[model samples]
Target: MKNLKVNPSNSLKTSRLVIRIFASLITLFYLIAFVPKLIQMLLGDAPERPPGADWEGSMVTVSFLIFILGYIVTWWRGLVGGIIIAIGSILMFLTHMMSASGEFEFLPFFVFSGPMLLCGILYLVFWWKKP
Candidate 1:
């Protein structure tokens, strides 16, 4: 009989690569969208809003920052970073949902949180399967 065996470490490496690429792509997309606003704010050229400004936008930004932090950390530690990414994605979704008059919207989630949440889940799954 022919013998065949699967090496778990190779699968783990492949999964890790996939998770890293997915997270990197997401981080790149986010940075492309966010860096301009960040630069504008840093340059003190952001448009001034009226008093009692939009707290929702600020909250979204905070959540987005947390997501970015998870992306950075994922390179170092997949398990903890995945947890952070999940939390960030949940916060991002809820914040945007609140800003949309407390209505659940699929479009916003697809655009912002869905891919990130998927990536985070993938990370955790692969981590758990690691040999």
Candidate 2:
């Protein structure tokens, strides 16, 4: 009889750790970003929205939900979480692109979406190589 031992590679371990940490941070960042608005709403001082801003606001809300879900799932399944985050990031990027008036408008989209895409890719890489 032969016995075999399976162990996770260091890269896999490191990647998993990184994914967990990054996912947590990403979730926290999104939640923190909403704190002001939440506070205002709770205090009955929510600012009035400009005309024709509802669609953009709704899109942002949906994307935020997707990111939250993706981060939550990352704790269990890295691949699924990565895909979800990637999808959310892509949707957000497209939304911003569609509404952009010029090159300057893409700055904010890139700033936010770039890290998200990177994190998503990192998670996928780790998931693919998981032992």
Candidate 3:
């Protein structure tokens, strides 16, 4: 295979563009998933508490904010934000499991953590490839 390039500068710019695209996608996904929850919290219309202060939801909120900050920093920090997002995802998964076993089927784990986990995995993969 030919390692063809219009020029080294073009190749570098292309690489940066790819990274930025991935970062933006991650940011957009998080924003779409989290903004509604934050609005609900602000409007004092947050969902019903899940037995114990809704720690899972709280983590999701905090991790989303951290991810936003990470986007402002560097992609590496953004990767850290992805890790926080993954933590939130894990908490959400646990909450769902607990809620299921507690004789009730309730929780918004799918909406709350699904994107977090997916974006975390996607960005983590990108971060690993980044030099």
Candidate 4:
């Protein structure tokens, strides 16, 4: 083939960097939030609560897919995925709160919800700020 190369400009490079570093980190965090449950499930244990297990798994998987799609598309959807994660976290918290004998603990909430909120903020600050 003849000499032909498609080179992305400087801005494209910078955007890619943001998506890979910021978006991907957030996505990974959200994914990690599910690992304890996922590990339990893999070991034949059910979640203490089950409303969002499947949804959370799907969201984590989709967030990873969005990172993969970054080569072709913007990683903006990771922000949306992060929002979904946060909502799921809230719903789970509410369900637990409404339970007759549930206790409120901060670690679970922080691990799941905090990363998601941060993900949204990072996306807004890094990506949405300009576009």
Candidate 5:
């Protein structure tokens, strides 16, 4: 019987493509949904806050901007982008908790950041495994 050979590199390449596509899609979605609003916020056009929400809002905005920067950077530098995305994800959660105060909502935070976190980890893994 002839021996059938399996190429590990092909599988690795496939995984890399999969992760890249997922990351790209996530980035695209966020960019489309928020980029315009983010621009407005950054340009000092954001709607007025109630009273003491400025700090919390700024924290949340900065965290999201960090995540977006990571998304843009991932195309060029996977490892660095991954680190940034991970940091941003945690910051998003923490800032959210700070704003919530008494009633903490875990589901919303996880739902928003979980996919980004997963992609960041995958990016780091692929970068480390690269030959």
Candidate 6:
């Protein structure tokens, strides 16, 4: 077997590619997750709204829009997009954590937060060193 040398630029490109893909995936996941709820609400199939439901729903809608915008920017403006995604991911992770009780389940938190955080960090690192 022959030893292979890795080029730093090539590695960086690879990392950026991975980050872009991850961002896209996260955006897709959010779309998939939210569209059903959105349709349900529109169709009046959602459960009865509690107090402050409108405010909560509005916030969620805004956040999802922001996430989509961040994802689109990630392909062009890495650092800014990364910060947006990272902040969103952190908020989501914290929300899941706060909602869990003694019988906590890790899957929900991990599913929502893991890829966003990982790719966001990678994008930040790569973009930070670009210039």
Best by lDDT: 1
Best by TM-score: 1
Q: Count clashing residue pairs in model 5.
A: 0
Per-residue accuracy of model 5 over 49-104 as CA lDDT, tens digit each: 53225787677667778888987898899899999988888887777677747566
Residue 127 Cα positional deviation in candidate 2, in Å, after optimal superposition? 0.6
- Put down candidate 6 lDDT per residue, 5-119, tens digits, no spaces: 9888888888778767767777788888878777787788878662226654454455556667767778778889888877877765665555526444589657766776777
Residue pairs clashing in model 1 are none
TM-score result, candidate 5: 0.77
Residues 15-64, candidate 4, lDDT per residue (tens digit)? 64764676456556645755676677677676475324555445444543
| TM value for model 6 | 0.74
Ranking of all predicted structures according to lDDT, beginning with the best and ending with the worst: 1, 5, 2, 6, 3, 4
lDDT of each: 0.82, 0.75, 0.60, 0.51, 0.78, 0.71
Stretches of model 2 off by over 4 angstroms after superposition:
1-8, 48-53, 100-104
lDDT of 1 by residue, 37-72 (tens): 777777878786421247877777877888999888
Off by over 4 Å in 4: 1-23, 29-86, 92-101
- Looking at model 2, residue 6 earns an lDDT score of 48
Weakest lDDT window of 10 consecutive positions for candidate 5: 44-53
Q: Which stretches of candidate 6 lie over 4 Å from their true place?
A: 1-5, 47-63, 100-104
CA lDDT, candidate 1, residue 94: 82
**10 residues in a row with least lDDT, candidate 6:** 50-59
TM-score (C-alpha, index-matched) for candidate 2:
0.80
TM-score of 3: 0.50
TM agreement with the true structure for every prediction? 0.85, 0.80, 0.50, 0.43, 0.77, 0.74
Question: Each model's RMSD to truth, in Å?
Answer: 2.9, 5.0, 5.3, 9.2, 3.4, 3.6
